[model samples]
Target chain A: MPQIAQLAATYSSQIFWMLLTFGFVFFVIGLGMVPKVQSTVDARDKKIADDLDAAKASSAAADALEADWRAKENAARSDAQARLAAAKADAAKDREARLAAADAAIGEKLAAAEAQIEAGRGKALGEIEAVAAEAATDIVRRLAGAEVSSDAALQAVKAVI
Target chain B: MHQFTIEPMFGTDHWAIGGYNIAFTNSAMWMVLAAVVIWAFVALGMKRQLVPGRWQMAVETMTGFIDNLLSANVGPEGKKFVPYVFSLFMFILCANLLGLLPLGVIGSHAFTFTSHFTATGVLAILSFSIVLIVGFARHGFHFFSLFVPHGTPGWLLWLIPVIELVSFLVRPFSLGLRLFVAMMAGHILLEVLSSFVINSANAGPGWGLMIGVPSFLLMIGISALELLVAVIQAYVFALLTSLYINDAVNLH
Candidate 1:
């Protein structure tokens, strides 16, 4: 083959040019340019990680704030409930005391009215007895045409009239 | 044979150095072309954008591929050898693919430099030299232990080391010969089938219809296969080199 035949003549030239060209590739491109690309990739990765960490930190902070607000809201709600219950109890006690005082006043006024009616009835009965006695004495004296005493007529009215 | 012939571009007698014919040849031209192509490809992709465009991505992918290969094969220390392996891989890959370019349709021949033993042998020797240097530099005389597998019985120690030494020595030859033969054979097969197509058509219409058409079809199929082979050979070369470096670095 020509490859074998021409080996002694051309190998040096091939190797020489190959090394020169390949040397440029290795030194200039591989060493110089590749690191720049790799560093860019590295920087992007670091930025992404940092952004994620910041997001997580902010989310945690927000959660803590929400939890703190909820705790304060719960405390205030319980505090208002306690105050409302206390006021209701105080109002109920006051109403009961007032009702008891009003009941006592009404009982005292009704007893006084009953006592006044009882005294007036007794006085009216005594007057009616005197009028009847006088009438009896007049009748006795006119019918028999005899003298009749007023005290004796009152006694007869008290006994039978 | 004519396609494989290396014609000195500037006449053989005019470019001798130290009694060696150092005239620039077609193989040298292709090597320089491959280098230029690689340089342009890498230089154009150096935009350094955080979000790489397609061209930048393509360049990054090539370098990253070699980096990962070394990382996997030779471990962390393999990082130091990335530039060399990247250069080697790109050079061979470009040479192989460039050779297969259909430039013949435009009356210009593409020389496949990797098809020559001299070129591939030098590449193989370069990889082998690095292995030897790294082995000795890292492990001193213990690098010789590479020829001896662990847990060998005393009786088999002599025999095993001999076999291992032979295999180790054969690595460069095997590496160089594998690429050279594959590239050379594919080109030769394509050329031979092309000749058959031309010769049969000239002989008669019936022979052209029977042999020429089928040979032409087979040539097309083989040409496609050759493209795949070109890529595979470059990958295999880089892979084996890294694995050999792995042995040197890890001492196993």
Candidate 2:
């Protein structure tokens, strides 16, 4: 084969060029470029991890804030319910007292009215009796030509008439 | 045979060192081309985006492949040898594939430097030298224990160590020869089949239809196989180098 035949003629050049070029590849690409690529990958991995952590922290914080707001809302709702219940009870008590006072005052007024009516009726009856007695004395003196005293007439009216 | 010959690109005696005809040959040109191609592929693809582009991904995939191979074969300590192994793997892989480029249609043939034993031998020796250096540096004289398999019987020690020692010494040659022979044989087979296609077609329509078509189809299949071989050979070289380094480092 020419490969073997040409060995003496070409081996040195092949080796020399191979060494020079291979050395260039080792230094420039292997040594210089590889580390940069690795670092880039490393940096990307770290960034992803960091961003994930930050997202988790933010999500937790949001959940905590929502929980805090929920707690506050529940407390406020309970407080408003308590206040509303207290106001309802106070209004009921005030209404009951006012109704009782009004009822008592009306009863007192009704009683006073009834007493006035009784007094007026008594006076009217007394006046009516007096007037009838005077009328009866007058009738007796006219018909029989006799003097009839007011007391006697009133006694007759009370006894027979 | 002429395809395998390495003639100077410039004048025959233009470039030399120590009077040993180191003229700038086609083999040297291809080697340089492969190296440049590898450098550009890596350097240009390094956009360093957080999300890599296709080109950058390709570059990283290659480096990551070699990295994982080393870590798998040689353990964690193999991390330090990434650059060397990366260079070796890329160089051989690019040289192998570049040789198979269909540039013959353009009347310019690609020279496969890896098909030369001298070139592959140099690569194997380099890998072997690293193993030797690391073995001696780390384990001192105990590095020779690599020749002794763990838990060998006392009676078998005499035979096993010698056999192991011979196998260990043959690694560089075997490594070099494997790649060289694989690459050279694939190319020769393709060339031979292509010659049959040409010669039979030139003979007559009957011969062309009978032998040329089948040979042509076989060449296509073998060419695809050659592409696979190119990748597998590069992988095998790197894998063996790492395994050898593992034995050197761990002495097992």
Candidate 3:
């Protein structure tokens, strides 16, 4: 009861200090301190999000570069195969032309040699006939005292042969 | 007995103005001290770090706690009342802790300003006034309809409203008295137990250990309980304020 009674004498000062102190604290905290702490938290969150975005972008770039390199490599390989095929075709054509020319030159040489040999055999047979005619004429004269013509003797000799 | 007395800090026996006492008393000093301690704590605690230390953690924890309490009781709209509710909680909590210290330089025992009704009554009245003002501002005359239940029978309507009105009116007093009495009683118990130990020790050194040791241990336990009660009482004060504001805003 005495504590209750003391309220009348002490109320004003207590209330005054309470208001002053509480008001000061409210402004300092509600306006100042809380916002600072909140900003830090927000900044930390923003930093993490930015880092993740950067990582995603770099990975995408790497994937694109790898795809481009693989495509170029495939193109180069196909180009080399095409060139090799063209060179092989050209070499085969050149070899076939040379073989055909050699075959034609050998055939011409064989035809010329056969014609010359035929002419020589004709000449040698004619000479042998003349000699046989001469001998036949001499033998007829001595045995029968009658003379025969070269052309006739040759004909007779030929008929007998 | 002497701890409850409110003597002027200065030499004046009588200080008055307009038939009211405006004398600066020990209670006022402790109130100032409570404010200073809180300021120092927050000032030291707020360093704007990505990773908070102990002091910053403490400040942040208290802030988040009050925020949760406000949001839970009054929804998102409760955020506007953070300044007052936060101030009320911190002030009461600091006063209670300050009272527990060996701070009574002029009295026979330690003193706490919150143990007095005059101080706590002012805060309770202030909180109740906010509820009433805000309720009327938001709902106008419909605020009075809070006393009338939705399903009250015609025969019992008169009785229920009367009871409701009485309860509503007594809220400030109840709120004020609850904190004052709780703080006062805990401190008194601590005082009595410690005195018993002192008395036993004065009886004889041998008797001191025999009787005083147990009593001292019990006092230590009570002190821990007092510390718990201090925080709880502060929480209750803020919770009740939020609830009252909720009732005013929603008419529930």
**Which tens-of-lDDT digit does each residue in B37-120 have in candidate 3?**
888887787686777798877877777787779899999888778767887899899999888875445654456888888788
After superposition, the stretches of candidate 1 with alpha carbons farther than 4 Å from their true spots are A59-161, B10-13
Model 3 lDDT, residue B135, Cα? 98
Model 1 chain B: which ten-residue window has the lowest total lDDT? B10-19
Misplaced by over 4 Å in model 2 are A78-161, B12-14, B148-156, B250-252
lDDT tens digits, residues B83-102, model 2?
88898899999999999999
Question: Which digits, one per residue and each the tens of the lDDT, describe model 2 over residues A29-139?
Answer: 779887776677668789999999999999999999999999999999999999999999999999999999999999999999999999888887667777888889999
Worst 10 residues of 3 chain B by lDDT: B102-111
Candidate 3 CA-lDDT value: 0.82
True contacts kept of each: 0.73, 0.74, 0.56
What does candidate 2 score on TM?
0.79
lDDT of 3 by residue, A17-99 (tens): 66666667667765566555545545756878898999999999999999999899889988988888888888888778887
Find the 10 residues in a row with the least total lDDT in model 3 chain A.
Answer: A33-42
- Candidate 3 at residue B231, lDDT? 94
The best candidate in terms of lDDT? 2
The residue pairs that clash in candidate 3, if any, are: none
Question: Which run of 10 residues does model 2 chain A get worst, by summed lDDT?
Answer: A33-42
Docking band of candidate 3: acceptable
- The CA lDDT at B240 in model 1 is 98
Tens digits of lDDT, candidate 1, A1-44? 98778777777787877677777777877687767766666676
If scored against the real structure, what TM-score would every candidate get? 0.83, 0.79, 0.68
Could you arrange the candidates by TM-score from highest to lowest?
Answer: 1, 2, 3
Interface RMSD, prediction 1: 1.5
Candidate 3, position B18, lDDT? 72
